[model samples]
Structure formats: C-alpha cells, structure tokens
Target chain A: MRRIISILLLGIIALGITLSLAKIPFGTPKTKVGRYYIDKGVEETGATNIVTSVVVNYRAFDTLGEVTVLFIAAIGLGAVLTTGRRKKPERKIEPASLVLYTGCRFLFPLILLFGAYIFVHGHLTPGGGFQGGAIVASAFVLTYLGCRERRISERGSKLAESLGGLIFVIVGLVGLAVGGYFLMNFLPKGIPNFLFSAGIIPILYIVIGVKVGSELAGIIDNLIEESE
Target chain B: MSFLNHYIYYIGAFGLIFIGLYIVLVKHNLIKVIIGLSIMETGVNLFLISIGYIKGGTAPIFSTPEIEAARMVDPVPQALVLTAIVIGVAVLALALSLAIRLYQHYGTLNLRKIKEQRW
Candidate 1:
C-alpha cells in the first residue's frame, strides 16, 4: 500500500513539474550559444578555467565576503574556545599510531604539493580557492591526527589565517586602485592556458587556500580539544 | 507556489527542512533535535544536487569510452555536497559531544534542567 502511494505521489509530482516547466522560460531557448557564456570567458578574463573566471572575476566580491565570514568565524571560535589566562593553550595531543605516522610521512608532502598545485592552477581548472583551500585543511587534519604530539600550534594557526586574509584584502584593494575596479585582472594575461597566466586569480586562490586551510584546522583543533 | 510544482524535489526537500526546523524548535530531546538538524541538512544537500541535475543526465564518472561530457551530470554540486557531508559529520560529532557534557553536568537529558548557559 505504501509503495502504491509513493508511486502515485511521484507520478503526480512528475506531472506537476512537466506542467510547470512548460510555463517557465529557461534562459535563451534553443540557442546552443546561450547554454554557455556569450563571450569566451577564458580569453576575456585571461583565466584558462571558466569556473575560475566566474568565481574570482565575475563574483569576486562574493568570494571576498566568504573569506571575511571565515575570518570572523575563526575569531569567534578562538574566543569561545579561550580558557583560563595563558594566551596560547599548551594542551598537547598524544603520539599517534605507527601506521598513521608512517603513512602520513608518505602522504603529507604529496597532499600539500597537490593542494598548492590546485590553488595555483585554479584559474585553469574546475577547482578554485575554496575547494583547494579545504583540501589543504584536510591535509593538516591528517597530520594532526597522525602525529598527535605536534598538533598545530594555536598561535601559528591564527597568524597564518589572519595574515592570509589580510594579504587577500590588500591585494583586492590594490586592484581597485590600479584598475579602477575591485579585483581587476591587473597583470599581463600571460599565455592563455599556463599556470602562471591569469594574473591575480592564481594569487587570490593561493591566499584563499591558506586562509581557509588554517581556519578549518583551528576550528577542528578547538572542537577536538573542547570535546576532550 | 507554482514554482514548487516545477521543483517537486525541492518542494519535498523544503517541507523536510521545515519539519526538521519544527522538530528542533519543539522537541526537548537532544538526540531528536540533532536528528532533525541532520534531516534539514539532508534536505538542503538534496535540493542542491537536484538543481545541478539535467533532465536526462547520467552518472558523472567517465567509465565508458564514449562518455559525452555534456550529458554527464555536473560534478560540482556533488563535490560541494561531499564537503557539506564532511561539515555535517563534524557538526554532529561536536553536538553529540556537547550533549554528553550536558548529560554529565545535569545528570539528565532534560534541557529544561540544563539552563546554566541560557542567556
């Protein structure tokens, strides 16, 4: 009986959707060109990846806003997790398992390199600052778990995150001053599809990656420590 | 309201979100509230994934040689969902830990009795 009811409900839903789609106008109908951006975004933005153009150039302000939110969240976290006097908590994690230690020894460098690559090449690929940054953060988490004794220092985390955020905003402002627009692509467009090409996009992605990675690491650290 | 019909999946998803929100609001049971929060998050993730889905899209993985990239589902939302899932897990773990601490402090799960932190 339930199966029948579920099927009937699904059928009704399908019918409703079909009817509604008939009414809605989905962008430029029947225009293949309309499905994609009008101009070649890669050339216009000097970024190899179209997605990068959308994030770093088209919606640069939104990315900035996101980074600021992260910064605020980190500050809030630090405040909440703050305990008795000692500015930097000296609480230490234990030594990790041999397997984790050994495995991490092998994977950590590769992961870090890959993360940097992602951030560097974000302007020419599907990934971006957010994604790459998060990946790098996970790498820190791996190290934290593996070599528990040397879990990232709170001070270090804060410095890296805040500095990265400060650098990013400074870069954006520089663009506005130089190009008469915020996050303006300032440098030579470089070779169309190279890693060092897309002027400010690559640099911005790296900055974002650093900020995000540090913030996440700190948040995780606080949560784990608080739980214990 | 008419938009709901075209977005049937999202309509149901939104309904789940409200239902979950209500659960969180009304229920005193911490576990139940956590479950509600999870359900709400699932609704959001579902809506996002559905928004990225094409009418006749197939799996994004390129297992076959003649894989048509356009026909393949956009993997971006799925990628975002994966991050959401990780965040959800972290949040859940933290919530559960807090619940445990609450249990320790109050000697009971009744939220009414644990108003020490209430502003």
Candidate 2:
C-alpha cells in the first residue's frame, strides 16, 4: 500500500514536471545573465576559465557561505559521532599486504601534489578549489583503506581547516578595506592565461582548497574512527 | 525519434529523479533512503547542467586565443552545480552521521522498527 501510494505520487510529479519542462526547450541560450558573464568575465577577471571567475571572482560571497556550510557539516558530524564514545575492545587486525602499503605510501604524496596543483592553477585551468579539495580528501581515503594503522593527526587537520577558513576571510576583509566591498578583486588583473593573473581569484581558490580539503579529510577521519 | 533526440537528457534526468523519490518514499532502510537522496541530488545536478547546454557549444573557458565566447555554453549553471555538488557531499556526510547515531541508539536501521522514526 505504501509503495503504491508513493509510486502514484511520483507519477503525478513526473507528469507535472514533464509538462512544465516541455515549454523550456533544451539546448538553447536561456539566460541573459549567463551571456553577460561570458562576454564580460574575461576582461573583468583575467581568468581563462570562465567558471573559475564565476566561482571565485563574481560569486565569491556565495562560495564563502558554501564553505561555511561544509565546515558546519563536518563539525556536526564529528560532534555526532564522537559524543558518548566508550572504549571498544581492541581486535587483532592483520597488516595490509606489502604491495598495498607500498603503493599507498608512494601514491599519497603524488595525489596531494596533484590536488595542490589543481587549486593553484585553478584560474588558468578547468579545475578549482572544490575539485582539488575533493581530490586531496580522496588521498586521505586511500590512506585509510590501505594503511590501516596510520591515522591523520586530529590537531593538525583541525588547524589546517581553521587556517584555510581564516585566510579566506582575511583576504575578503582586505579586499573590503581596499575596495569598499567584501571579496572585491582589488589585486592586479594580470595578463590572461598566465599563472599569476586573475588578481585575488587564485589566492581565494587556494585558500578554499586548503579549507575544504582539510574539512573533508576530517569528516572522513571521524567516520572511519567511529566504524573501527 | 526526433522527440527522443530532443528530450533524451530530460527523460534520463527525470527518470533518475523519479526513481530516487520513489525509493526515498517507499524504502524502509535508513541507508537506502540516504542512497535515494544521493541519486536524487545527482539527477538534479544533471538537470541543471543540461539546462545550460548549447547546441555545439564548447566549455565556457577561454583557454585558447581563438575560443569564442559566443560558442561557449553558459557558465552560471556550471558554477552553481559546482557549489551544489560540494554542499551535497556535506549534507550526505551529515545524514550518514545521523544514521550512525540512530543505529547506535536503536540497534536497527529499519524506520518501521524505530518507534520515534515511524510515521
């Protein structure tokens, strides 16, 4: 009965959505705002990647809020999982295979480097802070799976997370002080396609990368600790 | 055939959305519900991305000097989806953590068995 009711509800929703969406034709330029951003974004931001400019330059305040939401989720997860923790009986665990351990040890630093490179070159390339941060966090996950005995330093991860957020806010504050608006791109818009170009965008993305990477890694750490 | 060509993406995206919603509404397992939520999010993200699609359009990046802004797809929705993906992950993690707490307290993941959780 429950399943039937739910299916009926979904069917009605599907019908309504299909009817409405049929009017909005696919594969068309629909929004003037998007067009404006595309046309003016390069000259205004000096970033080769228009998405980066949109994310870190034009809509930076929203990005900051998104980061804060991620931070809150991480903190909430940690709090939820860590509270009322009791001692668990230690179970004997087999060591990981030598091949697995060696591979993880070799690959971890390389992944971290690639993640940093992604965020650092965000303004010039298709990638940015969030993608890079996810990549970095994946490295941590790899470590957890392969290197069973190793643990991330709780203090260190927290510190990095806090510092990342602090730097983002400080940069925004600096921009506000200099340009009269928060998160203003007050720095020089250098030559396009260059690494040092795009003013404060690269800086903000890097800070976001660090903050997001650490926060995600911390969340992973909490969940893994809880299960084991 | 022309209808399929035109509305294929919309069909696929909405199919996933409906499936997810159905799972969420009908599934009793907490983990399954969470999985359903994830599928729904993925569907929504796809829908948003497809909304910005331009026929024969390139990515909205000026990586080369010859790349024309006129030929590039919309950057706005892509940017929105970028943040949305991150936020989705955060929400998923939080939900899973709550599920963990629920399991720990009740010793079962079934919504029907848990008195407080049952509607």
Candidate 3:
C-alpha cells in the first residue's frame, strides 16, 4: 500500500515535470547573463576559465556563503557524533598488508600535490578549489583504509580550516577597503592564460581549496573515529 | 526519432530523479533513504547542466585564442552546478553522521521500527 501510493505520487510529479520541461526547449542559449560572462569574462577578470571567473569573481559573496554552509555542516557533524559518547575498549586489529601500507604512503603526497595543482590553476583550467579539495579529501579516505593506526592531527586540520576561512574573509575585506564593493578585483589582472594572472581569483581559490580540503578531511576523520 | 535526439538527456535525468524519489519513499533503511537523496541530487545537477547545453558548443573555458566565445556552453549553469555538488557532499556527510547516531540509539537502521520516525 505504501509503495503503491508513493508510485502514484511519483507518476504525478513526473507528468508535471515532463509537461513543464517540454516548454523549455533543450540545446539553446537561454540566458543573456551567461552569454555576457563568456564573451567578456576573460578580458574583465583575466581568468581564461569562465566558470572559475563566475564562481570566484562574479559571484564571490555567494561562494563565501557556500563555504560557510559547508563549515556549519562539518561543525554540526562533529557535534552530533562527539556529544555524550561512551568510550569503548580498543579491539585488537590486524595490520594492513605491507603492500597496501607502502602504496598509500607513496601515493598520499602525490595526490595532495595534484589537488594543489588543480586549485592553483583554477583561473586557467577547468578545476577550482572545490574539485581540488574533494581530491585532497579522497586521499585522506585512502589513508584511513590502508593505514589503520595512522590518524590526522586534529589540531592541524582545524588550524588549516580556520586559517583558510580567515584568509578568504580578509581578502574580501581588503578589497572592500580599497574599492567600494565587497570582493572587488582590486589587484592587477595580468595577461590572461597565465598562472600568475587573475589577481585575487587564484588567491581566493587557493584559500577555498585549503578550507574545503581540511573541512572535508575533518568530517571524514570524525566519521571514521566514530565507527571505530 | 528526432524527438529522442533532443530530449534524451532530459529523459535520462528525470528517470534518475524518479528512481531516487521512489527509493526515498519506499525504502525502510535510513542509509538507503540517504543514498536515494544523493541520487536525486545527482539527477538535479545533471538536469541543470543539460539546460545550458548549446548545439556544437565547447566548454566555456577560453584556453586558447581559437576557442570561440559564441560556441561555448553557458558558464552560469556550470558554476551553479559546481556550488550544488559541493553543497550536496556536505549535506550527504551530515546525513550519514545523523544516521550513525540514529543507529546507535536504536541498534537498527530500519525507519519503520522507530515510532517517532513514523508518519
């Protein structure tokens, strides 16, 4: 009975969606704003990657809010898992295979470097802080799987998280002080297609990358510790 | 045949959305419901990306001088999806943590068994 009711509900919702979606034709230019961003984004923001320009430059305040949301979720997860916890006696655990431990130790630093590379090249490439941060977090997950005894330093991850957010806010405030608006592109936008160009964009992205990476790693750490 | 060519992405995306909805609605396990929610989020993200598709268009990046601005897909939707994906991950992690707490309290992940969770 419950399944039938839910199927009926879904059928109705699907009908409504299909009817509405048909009116909005596929494969066409729908927004004037998107067109404008593509045409002038490089010249204005000195970021060859238009999406990066849109995220870290055009809608930076919105990005700040997004970061805050992620931070709150992390803090909430930590709070939810840690409160009123009873300690359990540690159980004897078999060590990971030698190959697994050695492989993780070897690949961890390489993965971290690749993630840093992605965010640092945000202005000139397809990726940005969020993608890079996710990569970094995945590395930590691998560490947990292969090196059971090893743990991330809680103080260090928290410090990185706080510092990352602090730098982002500080940059925006400095931009506001120098210019009239929040997150203004106050620094010189050098020639496009270069790593050092796009001024505060790369800086903001690098900050976001660090912040998101540490926050996600902290979340993973919390979940792993709770399970064990 | 022509209709299928244009609406394939829309169809696929909505198919995912409906399947996710069904799972969330019918599944008794809290973890299954969370997985369904994640699938729904993926469908929504895919739908958003498909909306910005332009015929014969390339990515929105201006990596080289030859890439034409007029031929690039809309950057707005891509940017929006980027934000959405990160937010989705955050929400998923939080939900999983909550599920962990729930399981600990009740010793079972079945939502039907939890009286307060029942409608």
Candidate 4:
C-alpha cells in the first residue's frame, strides 16, 4: 500500500512537470542577444559556432559556475566515500588480456590529444570547456577500467585538478583586476578568425578540461578502491 | 527523420519519463530507483536532441555532398547531450556508491528502513 501510494504521488508530480513543459516555450525570442550574435560573434570570437560564443563570452560566469558544480561534486564524493568506519583493502586486479591492454595503450594518447585539441580550439570551433573536460575525463576512465592492474598516480591527478581549478579562478580574476567586470575578455581582439584573438577563453577551457578529467578520475578511483 | 516528424514519439517519450519517475518514487530497491532516474534522464536528452533535428536533415558531419552544412542538424544540442551523458554517468556512479555504503550499514537496500541517516 505504501509503495502504491508513492507511485501515485510520483505519477502526479511527473504529470505536472510534463504539463509545464508542454506549455513553456523553447527557442528564445530573437532580440538583443540574437542581434549581438549576428553582429559580433561570427568572426570576432573566431568561432564558427555561436554556442561557443554564448558560452565563452556573453555569459562566461555561468561556465565558471558549472565547473564549480563538478568540483563540489568531486569534493562531496570524496567526503562521503571516506566516511565509512572500515577502509576496505584495495584489492588486486587481474592483468588485463594482452589484446585489451595493448588496444587501450594505443588509444590513450590519441584520446588525450583529441581532448586537448578540442579544448584549445574551443574558440574556433564547437567544442568548449565542459565538452573538452569531459572528453579528457573519459580517457582517464578508459585507462582506469582497462588497465586495472596499474595504480593511478593520485598525486598527479590531484595536482591536475587543483591547478585546473586555480587557473580558472585566476583567469576570472584577471578580468576583475584589469576591469570591473568578471570574466571579461582580457586580451585585445586580434585579427578575426585567428587562434590568438580569443584571449583567455581558450586557455580557460583547457584548464576546465584538465580539472574535469582529473576530478572524474578521482571519483572513479575512490569508487573502485571501495568496491574492491 | 522520424524523430522530427513523429508526434507520437514525443508522447511516448513523455510517457516514459512519467513511468520512470513513478518507479523511482515507489521502488524499494536502490538500483531500480537509479535505473528509473537514468531512464528519465535519457528521455530528457532525447527530447533536447530531437528539437535540433530538422526534417530530412543529415548528420552534423560535413562529409556528405547531398546535404550542405548549413541545412544539417544543429550540432549544438548533440554536443550538449554528450556532456550531459557524462554528467549522468558521474551522478550514477556517486549514487550507486552511496547506495553500497547504505547497504553496508543497514544490510538491505530498502529505502524505508534506511531512516537512520534521514533528516
């Protein structure tokens, strides 16, 4: 009876959300922001993608907030997982079959390079901080899962995450220090369609990607260690 | 694409979201609840991706001659969905680990009995 009641209540809530979504409109009204995109974002940002414009420039503070959420989640996971009374012995993992291990070894550098490419080119392309960061994290995940017998270097991962996070803060601070606004494009806009023109945006994205990758690695490491 | 043209799929997707929520709310098993949450998330991502798809639109990859890049499906949502899927995995892993810890304490996966940690 209790379970049934809970289901009924959930159904009602779901119906309410559905109705709300049905009524709420998407595709924002073409207004000042839309015009701004047409006027400046196309080339000045050197990005072929408008979404990158919105993320990197028009509302960069929001991206900072999003990265912070991931950071907080990583910290929270660390806190929660460490709370148990008994620390389970990190168990032995069997050496992966030669086929799988060799394959991942071949793929790891390629994936990391791809992630770095995405991060640095965020200003000139569709990929940006979050996307690139997640990609880097994914590479780490594949390495952790496939190379089970190997130990993840905790110190390196921690340094990567912390430095990534610190760089983000410093990037924003440069905006505040140089001008009043937070996350202002600190560098002078160079010739349109060039890599150097986007200023701190590309660098910031690289930092975000590294941070995300390492934080995700930490989460996986803790989970696997505990589960063993 | 069928996803762009079909009104029925939208309804079905909404229905899936609804059912998933219902399961998540009522299920005693923690894994089932997580599954329910994941299904709901997939439905949301599907809806987001579908909105960007145009009728007869080709994939975002620019290798095709028949379809121009401008007319292809918007790549923005596809990119966002990729990020969202990773976030979902992170969330799911954290949730499952917490569930494991809870099981250790209570010796069962039932939510109702795990009231010791509840506010």
Candidate 5:
C-alpha cells in the first residue's frame, strides 16, 4: 500500500516537473544575468575562470553562508555522534600490511601538495578551494584507513578550521572598511592568469579550502571515534 | 526521436529524482532513506547543471586565447551547483550522524520497527 502511494505521488511530481521543464528549451543559452557575468567577469574580477569569479566574487556572500552551513553540519554531527557514549570496549582493528602502510605514508604528502596546488591555482584553473579541500580530506581518510594506530590531532584540526573562518571574515571586513562595501575587492587584482592575480578571490578560496578540509577531517574523526 | 534527443538530459535527471523519491518513501531502513535523500540531491544538482548547457558551448573558463565568452555555457548554475554539492554532502553527513544516534538509542535501523516512526 505504501509503495503504491509513493509511486502515485512520484508520478504526479514527475508529471508536474516535466510539464514545466518542457517549456524551457534544452541546451540553449538563457539567463541574462549569467551572460552579463560572463562578459564582465574578467574585467571586474580579474580572474580568467568565470566560474571562479562568480563563485568567489559575484556570489561570495552566498558562498560564506554555504560554508557556515557546512560548519554547522560538522558540529551537529559531532554533537549527535558523541552524546552519551556507550563506553564499550574498543575493538581492535587490524593494521595494514607493511607494503600498504609504506605506500600510504609515501603518498600522503603528495596528495596534500596536490590539494594545496588546486586551491592555490583556483583562479587560473578549473579546480577551487572546495575541490581542493575535499582532496585534502580524502588524504586524511587515506591515512585513517592505512594507519590504524594513528589519529589526526583534534586540537590542530579545530584550530585550522577556526583560523580559516576567521581569515575569511577578516578579509571581508577589511574589504568593507576600505572599499565601503562588504566583500569588496579592496586589494589589487593582479594580472590575469597568474598565480598572484584575482586579489581576494584566491585568498578567500584558500581560506575556504582550509576550513572545509579541517571540518571534513573533524567529521571523519568523530565518526571514527563513534565506531571505535 | 527529436523530442528524445532534446529532452534526454531532463528525462535522465528526473528519473533519478523519482527513483530517489521512491526510495525515500518506501524504504523501511533509516539508512536507505538517507541514501535516497543523497540521490535526490544528486538529481537536483544534475538538473541545475543541465540547465546551463549551451549545446555547443565550452566551459566558462578562459583556458585558451581563442575561447570566446559568447560561446561559453552559463556560469551561474555551475557556481550554484558547486556550493550545493558541498552543502548536500554536509546535510548527508548530518543525517547519517542522526541515523547513528537513532540506531544507538533504539537498537534498530528499521523505521517500521520503531514505534514512533509510523506514517
């Protein structure tokens, strides 16, 4: 009975969605705002990547709210998972083989470097802080899986998360003070396509990368602790 | 045939969304419901991205000198989806954490077995 009801509801939803969507032609350039951003993005933000310019410049405030939502979720996860611990005896997890351990140790730093590279070159390339941060978190996950005995430093991760958020907010405040608007591009937008260009965009992205990386790592730590 | 060619992406995305919705509604396991939620989010993200496609357009990046701004796909939806994906991840993690808590408290993952979970 429930399955039938669900199917009926879904059918209705699908019908409504399709009927509405069918009017909008496929694979066509729409959205005047998007076109404006594409045309003016390079000049206004000095970033070769229009997506990056839109994300960190035109819609940065939205990004900040998104980051806050992530932070809250991480905190909520920790709170929910850690409450009223059962105090069960810790189950022993078998250590990885010597070869696996050595390989993971060797690759860890390289993965971190690659993640850092992605966020640092966000303005010039397709990758950005969020992608880079996920990569960094994956590196943490790798370490967790490969090294059974090792644990990430809780204090250090928390500190990095806080500091990253602080940097973002401070940069925005500084922009407001200097440019008379919040999140304004107060600093000089250097030459396009260079590592040093895009002013606050790259800087904010790096901050976001660190914040997201630490938050995800912390979430992983909390879940691991729960299962442990 | 032409209709199919034109609306295939929309059809595919909506198919995912419907499947996700069915899973969320009919599944008895709490974890399955959360997984469904994630799948629905994926469909939504895919739909947002598809809305930005320009048939023969390139990405919105200026990777080369010859890539014209007029020929690029919309950047807005891409930007929106980027953050949405991260937010979705966050929400999924939170929901899973809640599931873990519920399992710990009730000692069961089946929504049907949980007395208060009856629809």
Candidate 6:
C-alpha cells in the first residue's frame, strides 16, 4: 500500500517535472552572462579557467556562504553525535592486512600531493579548491579504512579548518580595505595561464582547499569514532 | 528518433530523480533513505549541468588558445554545481551521522520499529 501510494505520488511529480522541462530545449546556449564570462573571464580574472573565475572571483560571496554552510554541517554533525552519548565498550578491531596497510601508508602522501596540485593549479586547469579538498579528505578516508587502529588528531584538523576560514575572511577584508569592496581583486593579476597569475584567486582557492579538506576529514573522524 | 535524441538527457536525469523519490518515500531503513537522498542530489546536479549544455560546446576553460569563447558552455551553472556537489557531500555526511544517532538511540534501523519515528 505504501509502495503504491509513493509510486502514484512520484509519477505525478515526475510528470509535472517533465512537462516543465520539455519547454526548456536541451543543448542550446542560454544565459547572456555565461557568454560574457567566456569572452572576458581571462582578461578580468587573469585565470584561463572560466569556471574557476566564476567560482572564486565573480561569485565569491556565494562561495563564502557555501563554505559557511559546509562548516555548519560539520559542526552540527559533531554536536549531534557527541551529545548525550553513552559510552559503549570499545569493539575490538582486527588489524588490516600487511599489504593493505603498507599500500595505504605509501599512497597517502601521494594523494595529498595530487590534491594540492589540483587546488594550486585551479586557475589554469579544470579543478579548483572544492574538488581538491574532497580528494584530500578521501586520503584521510583511505587511511581510516586501512589503518583501523590509528586515530586522526581532532585538534589538528580543527586548527587547520579555523586557520583556513580565517585567511579567507582576512583576504576579503584586506580587499575591502584596499579596493573598497569585499573580496575585490585588489592584488595584481599577472599574465594568464601561469601558476602565479590570478592574484588573490589562487590564494583564496588554496585557503578553501585547506578549509574543506580539514572540515571533511573532521566529519569523517566523527562518524568513524561514533561507529567504533 | 530525433525526439528521443533531444530529450535523452532530461529523461535520464528525471528518471534518476524519480527513482530516488520512490526510495525516499517507500523505503523503511533510515540509511536507505539517506542513500536515496544522495541519489536525488546526484540527479538534481545532473539536471543543473544539463541546463548549461550547448549542442557542440566545449568546457568553459581556456586550456588552449585555440578554444573559442563562442563554443564554450555556460560557466555559471558549472560553478553553481561545483558548490552544490560539495554541499551535497556535507549534507550526506550530516544525514548519515543523524542516522547513526537514531540507530544508537533506538537500537534498530527500522523506521516503523522506532517509537519516536513511527508514522
């Protein structure tokens, strides 16, 4: 009976959504602003990657809000899980196989390096801070899975998260002071297609990378500890 | 055939969305519901990305000088989706954590069996 009702409800909703979606033709250029970004993004942001420019330059305030949202979620997870917890006896965890443990230990630093590469080259490449940060977090997750006995330092992750958030806000405030607008591109935008180019963009992205990386690792830590 | 070609992406995206909705509405397990939510998020992300597609467009990045501005897809939606995807991850983790609390408190994973969650 429940399945029947849900299917009926979903069918109606899907019909409505599809009917509305049909009017918007697929595979067509839309949004005038998108065109503007494509034409002038390189010159304005000094970043060859237009998506990075849009994320870190054009709509930076929105990104800040998004980062805040992520932070709140991480905090909330910690709060929800830690509150009123009855201490259950620790469950014995079998050690991971030697092969698996050695592999994770070997690959962990390499994964961190790759994530750093992604965020640092965000202005000139396809990836940016968020993707890079997630990659970094995955490195932590890999460690958790392979090295069951090892616990991440909660204090260190929190410190990195706080520092990253501080730097982002500080940079924005500096822009506001110098350029009279929050998150303004106050620094010199060097030649495009270079690592050192795009001024505050790479700086902000690196900050975001660290922030997201630590926040996610913290969330994973909370969950893992709770499960254990 | 032409009609199918034009609407395939939409159909696929909406199909996933509907499937996720079904799981969320009908599934009894809290973890399954969270998984359903994640699936729905993936579907919505797909829909958003499809909205920015052009028939013969390349990515918005100018990795090479030869790539033309006129031939690139919309950057705005891609940027929005990037943030959305990360936010989705955060939400999923949070939801899973809540599920863990629910299981711990109730000692079972079933929605029907949990006294507080009974409909």
Using DockQ as the measure, which candidate wins? 3
Q: What local lDDT does model 4 show for residue B114?
A: 77
Clashes of each: 0, 0, 0, 1, 0, 0
lDDT of 4 by residue, A73-186 (tens): 777777777864885676667788888899888888899899888888776656766777777777877887777776668899989988987888888888999978888787
lDDT of each: 0.67, 0.92, 0.92, 0.71, 0.90, 0.91
Native interface contact recovery, all models: 0.00, 0.88, 0.91, 0.18, 0.88, 0.97
Give the per-residue lDDT digits (tens) of candidate 2, residues B1-119. Answer: 99899889988889889889988999999999999999999999999999999999999988888988898999999999999999999889999999999998999999999999898
What would the per-residue lDDT of candidate 6 be over residues B21-103, giving only the tens digit for each residue? 99999999999998898888889989889999998989988888888888899989999999999999889988888888887
lDDT of 3 by residue, A132-152 (tens): 999999999899999888889
Q: Model 1, residue A10: what's the lDDT?
A: 54
List candidate 1 segments past 4 Å from native.
A1-40, A86-94, A226-228, B1-35, B52-112, B115-119
With a 3 Å backbone cut-off (N, CA, C), the pairs that clash in candidate 4 are A133-A209
Query: What residue runs in model 2 are displaced by over 4 Å at the alpha carbon?
Result: A85-93
**Per-prediction TM-score:** 0.69, 0.97, 0.98, 0.80, 0.97, 0.96
lDDT of 5 by residue, A46-67 (tens): 9999999999999899999999
lDDT by residue (tens digit), candidate 5, B7-71: 88888888889889989988999999998988898898888899999999999998788899888
Model 6 error, position A53 (Å): 0.4
lDDT of 1 by residue, A1-228 (tens): 543554566557556754654443321123343124223555667775545665666667867776676666556555555556755556655677889899997888888888888877777656666777778878888877786665688889889887887887788789899989877888778876677787888888888778777777777787677554
| Clash count, predicted structure 3 | 0
lDDT of 3 by residue, B6-101 (tens): 999988899899989999999999999999999998999999999999999999988889888889999999999998999888889999999988
Which portions of model 3 show Cα errors greater than 4 Å? A85-93
The fraction of reference A/B contacts recovered in model 1 reads: 0.00
iRMSD, per candidate, in listed order: 8.8, 0.8, 0.7, 5.0, 0.9, 0.9
